[model samples]
Target: MAHTTKLNTDLTGKTALVTGGTKGIGKAIADELAAAGARVIISARNAPSAESTHHFIAADLTNAQQASSLARQINDEFGGIDMLINNVGGLTTPGGGYSALTDKHWEDELQLNLIAAIRLDREFIPVMTARRNAVIIHISSIAARQALWNLNLAYAVSKSALNSYSKALATELASKGVRVLTVSPGATKTPPMEKFIADYAAAQNIPEESALAQLLQQTGGIPMGRMAEPEEVASLVHYLVSPAASYLTGSIYAIDGGALPVVS
Candidate 1:
């Protein structure tokens, strides 16, 4: 007979909502949570490229009205959720330091990366607080700390703001039975990241491998010698939102493979 070990991460009877959950890290989290026995719902601006088992809702979280509608629908249908994953952020701004960034560029990045999550949190907080224990995961980027000016200036600033906001919110909600935390992942192998590297290689007239190396070098290189898999990030998030992590809150957890030079 084979012996089996059980993990404390079982989420039976819990409901979860993952923003930008159609692809990349968001999709990974949605799948992981569902596998752990949670009823999962995913929201994205557009439909997924492939079929998904989780309940799908179309909502561009950057739009305030759509964010509100998404929350309303979830409440009306599922009553509420135990886990909320704000995973809809990205580096949409162009490279080239502050001079290359316009006011609109800054606004767009902040709106998507920070404000959208804040809006959703406000909408769900009341419901979440009423529950026994609720968790909110903010998906940030390692760029928040070691930003490459010519690559992700506006995006980095927005994520940094999100970090501060997450900590403060966690402090405020701790007594209310809600937990808020930030997860900052370094370079992960995803479709958008692959596209970014391919485009960079084409623009620089270099091979894809070289392009990846240059980008990693700019970030001080991952000591692990490779980028993270989306599933790996999902695993960390799974633990963070699980019963095992009930005591954790108000901190930025890095899944950067030692790419972030600082000790924080």
Candidate 2:
């Protein structure tokens, strides 16, 4: 007989902000948090579906002005947030060796993956610290450690910086009653990943399955034989931000399927 276990990851009165929460893993996380009874606020460059129940805000986080406006709107509308999820990042640069990346490429990657989170965190840290039990989660990638330079050189470097920043911030805030953590996911089954696989297949003139296999092999392959679902990642984020994880802070919670070859 199989037994089921229930998790205690409730966030009834929590107000949370999820940047890049319009779709993909971000949407999954926003939905999961709302289901746990939190008042979820989602922000992205585009609008969410009309059927979306969570409050939506449109802002390009890369722009300082837009980011500031976002913070103002959230503060005015909801006072402040109890949790922050910095998920607004991607591999937007062309993939090649060091020579392929220019100064702009490196700057863009850092702004999106590292500096964006740092700025947003700075804006809300005051209120979060006052709450004394707030949580800040930086959604990084496994590429931070296991970088495939040919595919995502700048992206990987940015995420590695993100991990380092998150650790230092966690240490600084530990005595101030706030928690900072990093969630590093391996290849997840999101719309972006699907598109990437499709593109690779087209570029290589191979079947999509073959393209996926090759891509997986490049990352040392996920031992679970599959990529993680967006919802699976969302579940981990929900747990980390919930009261049940009160003592958990300053750690990188990896949701990869044992893809990282060595212990971190």
TM-score of each: 0.96, 0.95
lDDT of 2 by residue, 1-264 (tens): 532323568899999999999899999999999999999999999998657999999999999988989998998889899999999999888766899999999999999999999989999999889988899999999999988878899999999999999999999999898899999999998888898889889988999999999999998898999999999999999999987788889999889999999876
Which runs in model 1 stand beyond 4 Å of their true positions? 1-7
* Runs in model 2 lying further than 4 Å from the true structure: 1-7
Clash totals in order: 0, 0
Best-fitting candidate, scored by lDDT: 1
Assess the local accuracy of residue 160 in candidate 1 as a C-alpha lDDT between 0 and 100: 94
Looking at candidate 2, what is the lDDT of residue 200? 80
Residue-level lDDT of model 1, residues 109-223, one tens digit each, is: 9999999999999999999999859999999998899878899989989999999999999999999999999999999999889999998999999999999999998888999
Kindly give the stretch of ten consecutive residues in candidate 1 with the minimal lDDT sum. Answer: 1-10
Lowest-sum lDDT 10-residue window in model 2: 1-10
**Compared to the true structure, candidate 1 yields what TM-score?**
0.96
